[model samples]
Target: MTVALWCILIAILLPYVCTWVAKISGGFRLKDNHDPRDFLDSLEGFGRRAHAAQLNSFEVIPAFAAAVIVAHLAGNAELVTINVLAVLFITSRLLYIICYLADWATLRSLVWFVGIGLIVSFFVVSV
Candidate 1:
């Protein structure tokens, strides 16, 4: 599969990674599984931020996935360019998560904008 396609998979899985981080930091247990949303909602500090990041990750997936797929279908952008942008988007997400966990609000927002810019770039390049 193309690297961009692989990135779609990574993007899909990223939220689960963030959720795991939140769960681990929040001391999730088997009982918590019965009310996972409540358990996650009750987290604070890094745990809470991680949960927020997880939700944000999920929120961005449709855009990222659609961007990648549309870019491929449009067939205007070079494969390498699409691949690089996809990698950069994933990198931005990882950094965003780290910034969220570390409470770097400004940096996280900047990284978020970068991710959004990358998504837009995919469409632009496809034109």
Candidate 2:
């Protein structure tokens, strides 16, 4: 598969990674499985930030996946360009999660903008 396609898979999995981090940090118990949302909601500090990051990660998947798929189907942009943008988006997301957990609000927002910009670039390049 193309690197961009691989990125879609990575993007789909990213939220779960964040969720895992939140659960681990929040001391999730087996009993908490019955009310995972509540457990996650009860988290604070870095745990809360991790949960927020998970939600945000999930929120962006559709757009990112669609952008990658559309870019591939449209077949206008070079494979290298698409792959690079996809990699950059994933990198931005990783940085975003770190920033979120570290409480770097400004840096996190900047990284978020970069991710969104990369998504837009996929569409732009497809044209």
Candidate 3:
């Protein structure tokens, strides 16, 4: 597979990896159901942030994959740039999750924005 495809695969899997980390750290179970308020208290305040990252990651990744594929097929000049941005998005997500778990609210939000910016930039440039 090409490097771009590899990056896409990593982007696709990062959330699941984060979920595994959360589970191993005794944060939350994949199948567990609990009140959001209660879960927030239970996580010592990291629950919402981590949950947001997971949810957002899921939403973003499929779009990234589709955009990359379309760009590739169209021979769009932005493929390389999109791939690079996708890598940044994935790395920022990892930092985002760690910051969320660590309760670094401001930095966590900043990292989340970076990831979002990369996604938006990719779409804008690819089109």
Write down the lDDT of every candidate, Cα atoms only: 0.97, 0.97, 0.67
TM-score of each: 0.98, 0.98, 0.70
Which structure is stronger by lDDT: 2 or 3?
2
Worst ten in a row by lDDT for model 1:
10-19
Error of 1 at 81 (Å): 0.5
Which should have the higher lDDT, number 1 or number 3?
1
Q: Please, what are the lDDT tens digits per residue for candidate 1 over residues 77-107? A: 9999999999999999999999999999999
Candidate 3 per-residue lDDT, tens place, 19-121, comes to: 5554445455545545533543355344445655566677778876776676566665465675677677668878977887788889988887787777667
What's the lDDT for candidate 1?
0.97
**2 or 3: which has the higher TM-score?**
2
Model 1 RMSD in Å is: 0.6
lDDT, model 3: 0.67
Q: What are the clashing pairs of model 1?
A: none
Score candidate 3 by TM-score against the native: 0.70
Pick the winner on TM-score between candidates 1 and 3: 1
